[model samples]
Target: MTRSQALTLKSLAIEAYQPGQFEKDLTRAEAARRIQMLRDEIALADSF
Candidate 1:
């Protein structure tokens, strides 16, 4: 797998350490930033 994809998965994995936990308190901007980063990583991976 590409580095970008791997990193994306890693970030998600970290965020999901305890399901439905962080989801409750994360602000809109923070969540958007994290998800946007994941999407960018996916796009980078797709190029590989």
Candidate 2:
């Protein structure tokens, strides 16, 4: 993931643990999907 995407993911994670730091919300499945997407993105980039 790029810097921005990583930041968003981090914010989501913080919300998961702390539950109020971020305004935007994601369900458990949504968060899982986004995390997987980032993993895929990073893996693909590293393959270059």
Candidate 3:
């Protein structure tokens, strides 16, 4: 993944409280997917 993607993924992971869940060598698509998933999870958590 690109540096920006990696940083965004890291930030999302940290926000979702799953900082260790991401892989270091993910593809750009996978990173984007994971970031979206994390954002969804955070939103779900906030709704409770």
Candidate 4:
């Protein structure tokens, strides 16, 4: 996914991790995927 999409997902993931959970529609696996995507982006930026 593009960075924007990943960012949106990451936000949702963060919210989901909260006491009430982030996205009511998103599964744990999906949250993990978003986290991974963000991590990948960070790693790419770090390498630059």
Best by lDDT: 3
Q: Clashing residue pairs in candidate 1, if any?
A: none
Cα lDDT tens digits for candidate 1, 1-44: 34454454456646545233234345556666666665665667
RMSD (CA, Å), each prediction: 10.5, 10.2, 1.1, 9.8
Ranking by lDDT, best first?
3, 2, 4, 1
Per-residue lDDT over 1-48 for candidate 4, one digit per residue giving the tens place of the 0 to 100 score: 445554566575455443333344555576667567665665666798
Residue 5 shift from truth in candidate 4, angstroms? 17
> What's the lDDT for candidate 1?
0.53
Q: Please identify which of the two predictions, 1 or 3, would achieve the higher TM-score against the true structure.
A: 3
User: Which runs in model 3 stand beyond 4 Å of their true positions?
Assistant: none
Question: TM-score for every candidate vs. truth?
Answer: 0.49, 0.53, 0.82, 0.47
lDDT of all the models against the reference?
0.53, 0.57, 0.88, 0.56
What tens-digit string does per-residue lDDT give for candidate 3 at 1-48?
889989888998988889985789999898889988998999999999
Candidate 2 CA-lDDT value: 0.57
User: Which prediction has more favorable lDDT, 2 or 3?
Assistant: 3
- Please list the residue runs of candidate 2 whose C-alpha ends up more than 4 Å from where it truly belongs after superposition: 1-8, 11-23
Pick the TM-score winner: 3
The total of clashing pairs for model 3 equals: 0
